[model samples]
Target: MQARSVAGEAARNLVTGTTRALWWALAFVVLVGGLAVADARVLVRVWQDADAFRSAGAAVQTLASEREQVVDGTRCQALSGVAGLTGAGALRPGAPVRAASMPSSDLTVWEVTPGVLDLLTTTARPVRTATGTTTGGLWLADDLAAALGASAGDELVIDDGRVRVAGVYTWPDDGRDRVLAYAAVVAVPATGTFERCWAGAWPVDDDAAGLLYSATSPGADDLRLGQLNSTRGSGYDLSGLVDARPTAVAPAAAAAVGLVLGYLAVRTRRLELASALHARVPKPFLTWQHLLEAGCWLAAALSVTAAATGVAALVGSPGPYLGTWATAGMAAGTGAAATLIGTLVGVLTTREKHLFRYFKER
Candidate 1:
């Protein structure tokens, strides 16, 4: 087959030449890998580290009627109501109030379930749970409990509610990972609890089957709406969950820049070959035509290697791995483009031997 001959010649060139192609390839790999690491640590972390997407809701009128909804994970579906905050003041006596059974000691450690917590590692504080309750209580966030200076079995008042320390924990911030630190949790009565209001509520779990909510208007109206029951609405799927598209882009860009440099390095030695073929081939052939072929092949090979290595490293560490095919494809395309541009420059200069000589002299 004609394909076989081309493949054979390409292989021969690789081995026959003692040119610095191998060295250049090694340099390209190092540049790409180093840049990738730096970009991921700095640029990608900036976008992915902070809470970019907000899960919010709005409520119209006072929810007087009893209503309940089950949640699976701490997803937007679990959000009850993004009810407009009517009053801009803190919760005071006689004010309308909403309470969640699963309280969160800290805002970052969003309580998704009774004992489970979810938070980005960059949130600063982590959750710490204690076991074997005593005089006070056991449930507390790591920071809150640490601030109390209480150890296991020690009694203290949190938000006015007496509690006992249990345990401390550190969680990974990677997007896919979930923290199921606590298993069993019981609420402390608000009467003797802290005066804080927001601390008494926590986000619903994404996987929780239902949501439980109660409205209280002290000294105005107190009605027993027995736990309202409601199931999550349909059409709720996690198909669009986990966005690595943005994260993958940065590395792809860096890889592209490296690929361009690689193409230039390769074409430097291939100048004579490209010139010889020019006469045998189409008249006035663009240097870019030959460079394009080399560019595509180089990008294809580099992209595959980068993705495989990136994925392997991500798997071993706490960072997100290349989860989506789109990410890999984008990375590959970026690399290909960079290589093409770099090769084009090199090949174009070869057309003018004078320019090529100037570059060598410089």
Candidate 2:
């Protein structure tokens, strides 16, 4: 019965105070709901763009500045067994050999284990032109493939050996690095011992940089580590492509919008509220009533915001639907909570005795 009375009173206030109700519904809804929609869509778009660049593979590229003995294959195997490591592979740190090829090419042959090649070119594998399924074969860069007049299954004689062109692939076309365009990686056969001069290890944790250097570059006679290098290659610097300030700024703006709008709405009814108080209406009831009215406005706002964002989700880049919707909900809920706080403060602090002065000024 108490709940019914409070809700009825709140609805009555909105009915009688139609102007204030309409003002809050239309004006504040645009202000608050617009912010929520922008925050959600931008967050989702950035996340989708981020997903294209993100990979579990390590970006750190280790190279030997000085001549050193080949790190044993056991080191990589040990790295695979470690906690932070996802996958480990090695590459030929030495210079690629300029091998003889069709039409006489300027490109060179570099050796990479099947695993390391997978780490670098995970997203850019091109289609095979011929029918052959062999892992221990040659992978040509698209430009290099065209230059050599090569396609998958074609024979290319390099200084290392005669290897078939497995396929063509593209490195991440980040618009800066051209090294991959002129390079070809030969995947060492499964049974061949690793004669690695370069190493690639994918680490799952952020603190694994030190572990990578220590594990791959051990200090011992007949064994030495290489210089730690960043393999970003136009990619490492691309992670920060989106501005992240909105993540923190949007919620704070919502709170401010809620607080200011909520307080103004309550103040408009201060004189009537004071008279009701002098008639012995409970402060708690008034506070609850104010909160309920504010909640109604907020619920309406959120509905509009959700609808707008839903349309955006359909048109925007594909991102996780649940997560984007959750982002909208959380932003709207934050504003609603802050509005309720402002309503409560307005209800408690307004005294009936001060109503005359407050009205006189208006």
Which candidate leads the pack in lDDT?
2
Residues 96-135, model 1: lDDT tens digits = 1111322443322222222122221122133444454322
Clashing pairs in 2: 217-225
Candidate 2 residue lDDT tens string, 1-362: 39889999999877788426677867656876777777777767665554444332224334232354344544543454556444455555335555576535445666655555655543444655446543666688787777778888888877666767777876544542344456777666333334443333332234543354443444533443332322423233323433453554666788888887888788887887887888888888888888888888777767776777666555565566776666665666677778778778878888989878877966
Clash counts for the predictions, in order: 32, 1
lDDT of 1 at 101: 26
- Provide the RMSD of all predictions against the true structure, rounded to 1 decimal: 12.6, 5.9
In terms of TM-score, the best-performing candidate is: 2
- The TM-score of candidate 1 is 0.43
**Runs of candidate 2 exceeding 4 Å displacement:** 13-22, 25-58, 65-69, 77-86, 93-107, 122-137, 148-167, 172-180, 189-207, 210-250, 305-331, 358-362
lDDT of each: 0.37, 0.61
Q: TM-scores of the models, in the given order?
A: 0.43, 0.67
